[model samples]
Target chain A: MIRIGIPRALLYYQYYPMWKTFFQELGAEVVLSSPTTQTMLSSGASRVVADTCLPVKVFCGHVLSLVKECDYIFIPAIRSVQRRVYNCAKFLGLPDMTKAVIPESPPILDIDIDVNKGKRVLYQAIYKLGRHFTWDPLKVRRASIAAWQAHLNYRELMSSHSLTPPQAIEKMLGSSEVEPKTHSSHSTSTQGTIAIIGHPYLLYDEHINHRLIHRLEQAGNKVLTPEMLTTEELESAIVKLVGRAYWTYEEEVVGAGGHYLESRIGGVIGIMAFGCGPDSLMMDVVRRQAARLNTTPFMSLTLEEHTAEAGVVTRLEAFLDMIYRRKRKQVEVCV
Target chain B: MKTYLGIDVGSVTTKFAVLDENNELVTNIYLPTQGKPIEMVQQGLKQIKQQLSNGADICGVATTGSARYLAGVIVGADLVKNEITSQAVAALQYIPQVQTVIEIGGQDSKIIIIRDGIVTDFGMNTVCAAGTGSFLDHQALRLNMNIEELSRRALDSQTPVRIAGRCTVFAESDMVHKQQMGHRTEDILYGLCQALVRNYLNNVGMGKDIQPPIVFQGGVAFNQAIVKALREELNNEIIVPPHHEVMGAIGAALLVHEEMVNSQNGSKFKGFEVSEIKYHTSSFECKACPNLCEIAQLSINGQVLAQWGGRCDLWERSQSR
Candidate 1:
């Protein structure tokens, strides 16, 4: 059986289960790097120069984690699904960057998922992988189709239930879900709810945000994110809210924010990194729309090396307090 | 007496400071770049112009940061310095005896070790998000707290939870686990502060002899919790000036002062009206070599001002003149 390694970064949050299922069906063992860590980050940091972005550095760390353990490491180059909607330059050059950074040349399975460039679709990308592994095209096609169907069904189920991709995979697989279950009592009624809008890379990555999600949960506030909504719902929400086309990820966030806004969510939180070209432009549009929806308080947080937690916490507390007071006044009026 | 203006257009924030003949700060503004640095600079200039004292003569201007070239063009600056020099100068001004300067911004962090008022060694962590101000900001949002309160909450903590500070993923999982284990929010927050300090010390502060008289500046310096954390971690008292956040701009302004006073040369400051000028950028991937360098060129009114991102100096020299 051919053994493959997948570093746990980038699209790993979205596509890990699908990749794992496909490889398993094909009788291949997939070795994944452990959840991102400092050791991994340091290893990657040492390997690359300082100018690379945080995501790329983390990706490099993941790649380094898999270098010695697996026969071949899979690093896909995804350009764009459509024209004018391209992935970040980092994603497009990931494979080449990895090869350049890693001194010991490990065999990389370079798969291009550039639908806009007329390269490969989801089925074709997997089918090509199947061909690379085995000469039997019929078997490869059958297995690929089955795997693709399973992935699609899985995504559909997740969308239907408004579950995150990981949550959906766990619900289907019934095992191997690493996330700890939240107890009902721990879900204390939040004084206010805040929507954290950002790409999964920035949202889920703890080092990037310094464990922001957990902190929010600990603060006893409901933290809503884009992953909790379906792509269609998110897209529709973005249209309803912004009335403008946005980058795919930004659209999901904006759409989710729209839903939150309509739900009269207490506060809106927009989280983004410094030097993020796309977010820099998209966030302004989101903020303006959020401002018009005055029923809910809104704050846009831009993170950079000089970001101070004190100021952020103050803003959040004030936002929550304002919501609490508003809710209290509304109750008083009703009474 | 002529006044000089210095603008530091960082990725996350744009800073502007005006200096008199003595290079003292007459006025300063620290504004969010919001990704439209050109617009921000223009806005900042307009605001500064309104605030300028009567009879203040505008002489020369300087621009610095990742978008220095563009900012320079917008402000019609005479000097453009990297963050290192600007920061160094700023640190020197606040504490002339300062041996080390730790500047952490929203997106990146740096450690500058100074020797006898000269920068001898420096390390920058631009690639990682672990030790950045933005990371803390994200965490603050997660805590549903304003950033200003983080330091107080951290100070109030009795027990600091042990969070994995190395990577964002592990830190998150660790935080979740700690929360499940019933750790106090304050404790968890303090633990995060420690974790961040640890990551910074391990990554950027690695292998460097950090001497005393350390000046900590940048927007993150405003976080007292981090300042305390750094003090505890380093086992040394850290100095934070009154204008810690706007040090870069202040430093740039001081440099302009030094240049003018030392050389006896006149200032080259274009007036505030230069902010109205239009600037445009165009990028083309150079296939001349396998490097496939995507050279991005910045121009004003069809005249090329600066070009960067090329691997070699091929395009740089051609655009220099």
Candidate 2:
């Protein structure tokens, strides 16, 4: 069987299950690059311009690590997910960038997954991807249907259990008979509710985010993320925040931010790459909305290549201190 | 005569404050950190021990600032708090009605927006040291003058020239250009101060409601020119409270005092002889994972007291076990 390599970065957290299912049904053995590390990040950073965001650098690193391990590397150019809303430019040019930078890389299986190009183009792209493994059109159609079902199941598992993508992915991919642990219900806990708004790449990449979700959970604070909300809920929140969604991924930051700010969460944190253009604009909108609301505390944490954990720790600790103290004061007033 | 000891180990300075049971500062010591946190902390402790009154007994101990963990382990602190909370706590103690706090330290600066004795919002300088005291200190060194003289000379300016304060390198070149263009030295110095103030307001104090009674503290409060620039820009009186330089230490001391009072436990202080304990510090790269975390270790007399800095708490947990 021809082994296909997948870089576990960027859209991997969002669409990995579907990609794995689609490729497996086509009879290709799917191989994944290891989780990110210091060496991976440094190697990736060397391959790209200094101004490129950290996520892109990480993606480059993942691609480099997969050089000798697979027959074909899969990289899809996802330009737009909705009718008019568009992804950042980096996503549109990822395949070309990887090919240009890594001259010794394996043959890349490239696909353009732009929804704005209409249903025919989308299906044609899927068919072309499947045709590489099998000549039967019926098999291709079956694989696509299986991929869609897997994606829906992935989304369902995340929202129902209030799990991050990695958590949900682990359960579905891990032992079949083992029951997944249910997260402590957020509704019962009134205090220490923190909403972390960021892209999945930034939120789930333990190396990039410094294990942010684990740290919060360890500290006994109930954490919330954009993935836990339904598509309709996020869409309405985005409309309420900025009239309409401009960026394809704006729902992660702006929509979730607007909804959380209105809710009675203790605080809201916006995490983003240092120079991401879309994130900068979306985060600013959230920050301003937070200021207008003035009911919940908001803080923005910018991640870069710097490995100094002291700065991030200090900020997180102080933000938590502020929340706990405020909650304590409210309790005192009630008594 | 029970007192609480608070130590703030920052990037540029190490401070020690001894506060009595009534939250009154009995003695405080401030000195340049000079990149040797352990040595500076020891020296500050020695000085504080000498200055403290004879009858004062240390009832609690706390640590704050960037190197707080190291200092906490060394001093056997009862509390370890972030500088933001410590600064706010001290500000609230100094003036209960304080709505804003602008703390400009050696390497970084932060703005805290407080309402009804709670921190509502806060922001810190990100990846830039342009609007901090160290920048002023560097300019003073370049001009062959002390930091105190820079402030005095800046106060004498009649018409200040505008220097670009967006980047420290550009700001240095801008200062040189202004000086070559026959601008008075005092005018250039004051211009640099205004530029830093503008950068602070733009970067660290962005998109927040900054209200008065605004109490400005930290090492930068010593510079009258920066204080004046802040006042001019905000069109409100910027109050620099007494003991501004030692406010972080005071806040830590105050927090520990509260903790000790509630718990009814004796202080965890290791005594003033920690200055003579011959402490040793070292670091090693952990090979447990591909992250290669550089873990820092602190020991005394060949006995490891604590280890930290790893992404995972493997070493930390092992030490505890």
Candidate 3:
């Protein structure tokens, strides 16, 4: 069977299930690099220039992680899902960038997805991969369709049950399809709440964020995340709070923040990967909204591989203390 | 009476300060950057307006930090300066006899050696987190200790555990190992502080003559453990100012004050109403060369204000009409 390597960055968090199902349906083996590490980061940093953002450096690290382990590494060039709503420019140049960083040339399968121009969708991207693997086009098409349907059904079932994408996939496929659960959530109280707002990939990846949910729970605070809310609810929250529509992913976070505010929560924690453009934009809007509402204290946590635990804890404690003091003052005024 | 304003628009935070004719800090505001520094500055200005005395003559304004260029454009600043010069100026203002300045911020860190109030040499570590405030914050979270309590706790330690502070991963793994080996929490915390201080001294503070009367400022100056560790490591007392975190803004404000006194320049500040303005950014790859530099263009009301991220000056030279 052909071995395909996936660098564990970027869309890997969103599309890993789809990729795995499609490749597996075609009788190929899928390999993913280990979670990001300092060695990997330093190596990747040296390979790229200083001007490149941290995410690009991380993407390079992920690519280097898979250099010696797999036959062909997959780096997709995604221009945009639709016109005027494009991914960062770095996503469009991943293949070339990875090649520039890697000392030895590894065979790279360049997958181009230009949905805006109506060039190809997810199925077509998989079909092209099937053709590259020397499989019959008709057989590949049928397998791709089955895999796509399975993926869609899996997502729907997961969302309906308020489960994570991986959880839903596992439930649909049973024991054989099980992947390690990287994130764990626990809530202590419905009244005292904090929202973990950020990209799904960063929030779900336990290794990258280092058990943030557990830490919050250990501190005796309840944590609410974006994945728990319905798509429409999230959208309406964003519209109501922001007074304008936003990009899809950012809308979810804005809506979550809105929900947190409306709930009269103690605080809202904005967690973002370092150098995330959309998160950067959302954080500003959220801060302004939080300030205007004055309902809850707000804090932002930016995570990179270099994130130090001491700084995060200090900020969290200070934020919690601020919230506690504000709540106490409100109580005293009421009394 | 003349009043001056200085703005420091960092990637993670934005600071603003107003100074009177005597260069005394009238008021200061520090806000999380939220990636919309221009908007934050406007919000800060509005807040400052509510506090300023009526009929106060504005002398001049200065902008600094990573977003200095953008801020300079937004506020119509009289002077634009880098963080190094701005920081040195603030240090000199507070500690005239200061020979060394160590500044640790959210995302980066810097060390400056000043000779007679002039910056003779300096080094900045922006590429990594080893010497930055965020690194210490992350470690505190892992240990489940309050960040503010970390410094005080370190001062109580009788034995300091040794942690590899070269990078986050090694530090974390080494910390776990030390904990497994049954080291006291306070000792481990103190060790981590020492490791970070050592790392800073070796890296950003490398190859510089760090002399006495050291002035420590920036966000991390609040960490007493770091101060203690530095004092113990270097065997010298470190001076942290009363307004440590807002020094960059203070320095920028002082610079504006100096400019107004010497140059007779009117303040170019855009005033408090700038919060209502809408700002947008658009990006395009320049095909002028094979470099294919992705250029980000910032605009307000359809007029281009600034452009950045280009390798050469090609996009900057283009008329945005």
Q: Specify the highest-TM-score model's number.
A: 2
Give each prediction's DockQ, rounded to 2 decimals.
0.01, 0.77, 0.02
| lDDT scores in order | 0.74, 0.90, 0.74
Which CAPRI tier for candidate 1? incorrect
**How do the residues B182-267 of candidate 2 rate in per-residue lDDT, one tens digit apiece?**
99999999999999999999999988688999999999999999999999999999999999999999999999999999999887
Q: TM-score for the second chain in candidate 3?
A: 0.93
Lowest summed-lDDT stretch of 10 residues in model 1 chain B?
Answer: B311-320
Q: List chain B TM-scores, each candidate.
A: 0.92, 0.97, 0.93
Q: TM-scores for all candidates? A: 0.49, 0.97, 0.50
Question: Which runs in model 2 stand beyond 4 Å of their true positions?
Answer: A175-191, B318-321
- lDDT by residue (tens digit), candidate 3, B209-305: 7999999988888888888898999999899999888899998888777777778756677766676778887899777644355788878888887
TM-score of chain B of 2: 0.97
Window of ten residues with lowest summed lDDT in model 3 chain B: B312-321
* Highest lDDT against the true fold, candidate: 2
Give the share of true interchain contacts found in each model. 0.00, 0.82, 0.00
